[model samples]
Target: MSLQEINFDGLVGPSHNYAGLSLGNIASASHKGDTSYPKAAALQGVAKMRGNLERLGVQGFLLPLPRPNHRLAERLAYDGTEAPALRAAPWSASSMWTANAATVSPAPDTKDGKCHLTPANLVTMLHRAQEWPDTKRMLEVVFGDRDHFAVHDIVPPTFGDEGAANHMRFCEGHGSAGVEVFVYGRPGGKFPARQHEQSSRLVARQHGLDPEKCVFIEQNPVAIDAGAFHNDVVSVANERVLFTHAEAFADQQGAYNAILAAFPDLEVVEVPSDAVSLEEAIRTYLFNAQLVTLPDGTMALIVPEECRESASVWAYCERMMAGNGPIKHVIPVDVRQSMANGGGPACLRLRVVCDPATVDPRFMLDEAKADLLEKTIAEHYPEQIDPDDLWTESLEKHVVAARQALLTALGIGELA
Candidate 1:
């Protein structure tokens, strides 16, 4: 069946205290290290994007891979005679900036269930410098289901002018439906980077799509520093595109007004600054909040709201609505550490697949599960547990504890 919606899986960067590579630093290294909070937040914002996809039967998993480490080898003489220099094996570690995890089966069928590495086709810091040969090797080793895999060649140590052109050719060779490219023009300008513009146009031409279909939206150039276009901007359900502009960036009114002028027919909603802070706006806009469509065709946007001096909170509401009524608050998930290094919940989870048959609008989690999970987690653990802290380690422990309690409560197992 054809997909009604496509949600990009996200990865959280390492935490500041975690003693690993920082995602913000990795993404901004090429630009002389002017870290964009919005970009960093967008990378971290993946944590906040869970419920909408979960409700749709779309499962998100963290990508599990180490960061690549590169060091040059010193030339050594063999048997006291100077000869040809020997090469040292490449060095690398699992990526901390890129959170990675996968589904697996306990059985030994070897094909029943296994983890697969889906390549991020976009450009990334590692690929930009061409420093991740080990990453590519590791991916080839684990992914058994190669047919289902596709690469996102937009980021990093791998992307360049030639890489972009090659990506276009690869997509065309495979006859992909089309490519999704986000265009962020220079502030107060109509065009994006010349290289990006040229590459995108070439790809569109190859796909036989009208150059006009290559959706372009105006975004603050400074915001681009934060990896703004890494997530969804165009809706997978109705193709409704969402864009945001903040007064801190530039002529806020004029930039937004100009964008509105360009796409007069598209639905454009000015997000309330009061409801969401500048940092939150930057992250949410870049991460691309989960857009779920109701049976009646009305859409709901689930976004991560940065609560007053606290961790991140999720806000579920209709984007078209003026007032905040009908808004429901999901339990705040503390991602302070991840956010510090530039990522959130949504960035940590990758949506592998969605069940189309279960898209019923009425479907939702039982309210009782919330209370049960909370109580089970609290009573079993004697240590202090803050409701606001939602780090992965804490959450995983709580979830396991809650499941055991739930099983016991259901008379299905003994809670030991």
Candidate 2:
């Protein structure tokens, strides 16, 4: 069966706040105490998804994970008392980035001819670790067609699987057999390695992927030290095209050689180190830009507004798009709220390749649905959320209520 790649973007949750809970993420730390606009952030994400559906015509939407996590509160034993550890749970909107939603093996690539999805344990960060159960539940409901879609349980926590954030696939087209690139990291720097090599291999084996088609590459320690916590921060791939920074991997040439060996038509678009340093790439999120194929059979680079704000990064993109290459245009999206919290256009989404008919209708969106979600956010979501507010009974009540209203509006029932 022919396939289309669907982008399942996580709607920013109601409890969105900046608490600097992500240890390795620079933006999260830099904007630690800043007040957040939960309503605005979610609307911004909704607008971006609407834009993708309008522009690309093949995108799907994923609802936000329930927040002000009651499970975490129960675990911490927050009996009307405040503790430093309790702060991370209520303010954790990190699940808004569903690229870490799950590691997906499309039906075309798996031996069983069933698309396999394993929700990430996300055990590296406390704030993110609590997301798997809820995420797994959502994935099961959305991709429940067991005949074609197989939703697997998360890998063991010790493995530290981070889902699609560190995984990339390459093939002639979405329907074709392809190479799965699993990028893992070892701890040798200030920033801890999030995705383990063992975790990547385990997921590959669980999905029954052909061993010959699976390639493992270690993330560059230098890149990790420079704050590229996830591979998506410095590299993104679609079809046979892999766009990456010069310093993205430990051995750039070897990674490219492996890709070339498996798929001869591989197009590696490397941003020269001279033009833009790794720091600039991470700051402007140049590599985090989504490299997607439009309906017209040509590719376009969907980048964050920060990329356009930077002279050097935008110029590089201009030059690259000017050429008669696979990438034909550049589109910038305003996800500054998400960017400020260490996510970008690419980070906000999970790419799943499958037949649209197989997905649950409630998980999909069009302009009409986007309008309803926007209306729901306007009605219930808080316009601003201060970190200090996370401690108040009123704020907690509001967050729970807001999420309940949203779920009711989306017809997904109570996920919280």
Candidate 3:
């Protein structure tokens, strides 16, 4: 195949902390005021990337966006007074969840035969809302080859878009034409629904996606209230297989029927709530996993270690594997830092299908680059960050230097 799906994971930032900035994210809320291990978190993320590179033969990583975004901090604290939420917003390392970076339409799915990407507005929350501008800039740098890629600005600020976390694609293979699905939410929920229907529709149109090949589905409000902030928290789709929970959509059967209407070959692996309750599923992040087609022609689910620790979730996996299902293997990884902050395996990545040759080499991974990154993180990253440390001058200097070291080591100081 000339084209392959590359997962671009975000390198966890040095400021990776538990500020409890994200609303509706239970893990983040529960872990507020806890000590954060920047060194271990960044190392774990690189190790995860290393695993994917070994399994898939290629991996890409996005650098951490500037932390304590002094610009945002200046604006929020211009009055010379400090509010806890406003104080923490500037220091959020939430960008590590690259799944929220952008929504991608591979070359095969677009009318122009070139990959198209639109950065998420992420207007729902303050910390995330500060992401799109920097995200768009980095996307343009890596995907700058105009003949092969088209990177669009985020949609108008009126609508909220949370990027690929709320999107899915289905096809015979990553290189073939595919049907895209956009999941949005309604107004009534205890927690604000992050993805809006208007934003999803605009992204589809901007990417030149065929209307007939796009399906829009409503997220289950109950799932949103239960802390499934993004649709990805409840469902994930590979080329032709969709492994999702029974209560994932507002109308689960109807949603499946809609997707099937567009692509008749779709395979559904539904985990009923009866077998594993929604609460247990969210806590373990059972569905927040990567379902990829392995080189050996079998499928594997790369799940969070928490999944293996949960009896119900692990038992369900065993039952699913015992059958002749499409998913053949289940690999569990440790990402406790990210997991505790409301992200699992899937949240740490953004999938873009294209020829590896078209991407900027600096962004792609090799054994040496991995070594350099780990070294920089080990030598420069802070060992631990306490909640009160967000206000310290020393922490600010250290966080900035840590990122600069990584950039210099990788010879991509332009990003710094």
* Winning model by lDDT: 3
Residue-level lDDT of model 2, residues 230-306, one tens digit each, is 99999999998999999999999999998788778899888988999899999888888788888788998899999
Off by over 4 Å in 1: 4-53, 60-62, 67-181, 185-209, 222-238, 241-243, 246-265, 272-280, 283-288, 294-298, 308-332, 349-416
CA lDDT scores, all candidates in order: 0.32, 0.88, 0.93
* Predicted model with the maximum TM-score: 3
- What is the TM-score (0 to 1) of candidate 2? 0.97
Per-residue alpha-carbon lDDT of candidate 3 for residues 80-159, written as tens digits (9 for 90 to 100): 36777787898889999999999999999898999999999999999999998889989998888899999998989889
- Name the regions of candidate 3 deviating beyond 4 angstroms: 78-80
RMSD of each: 12.9, 1.3, 1.0
Pairs that clash in candidate 2: none
